[model samples]
Target: MISRASLRFSLGRFTTAEEIDAAAAKLVAVVTHLRQNAPAFEFD
Candidate 1:
């Protein structure tokens, strides 16, 4: 059988544990990249 649903926000739907882990790794890399490229704040 197949499953499906509708939601307000669709981030994603992982079918297996491995898929979730892969997504987590990618998320970490994205966060690291964002932190590295984030704009610096300056106040006068």
Candidate 2:
């Protein structure tokens, strides 16, 4: 079976859409790097 994992993020204050998108982009980049460097790691 395959299990999915995720991260929970909370901001102390309100944030703009651009800020949220930037954060998500960073997370995707990190995940992509891990997928490239680590054979067993994968994310969607």
Count backbone overlaps in model 2: 0
- How do the residues 1-44 of candidate 1 rate in per-residue lDDT, one tens digit apiece? 22223435245564677876887799779877866765555111
State every prediction's TM-score relative to the real structure: 0.57, 0.58
| Number of the top lDDT candidate | 2
Q: lDDT values of the candidates?
A: 0.61, 0.74
lDDT per residue for candidate 2 within 1-44, as digits (tens), equals 33446888887667889898999999899987766776453332
Model 2: CA > 4 A from native = 1-5, 11-13, 39-44
**Candidate 2, pairs of clashing residues:** none
Mind sharing the TM-score for model 2?
0.58
TM-score winner among the candidates?
2
Instruction: State the lDDT at 13 in candidate 2.
Output: 68
Positional deviation of 15 in candidate 2, in angstroms? 1.1
For candidate 1, the per-residue lDDT at 7 reads: 39
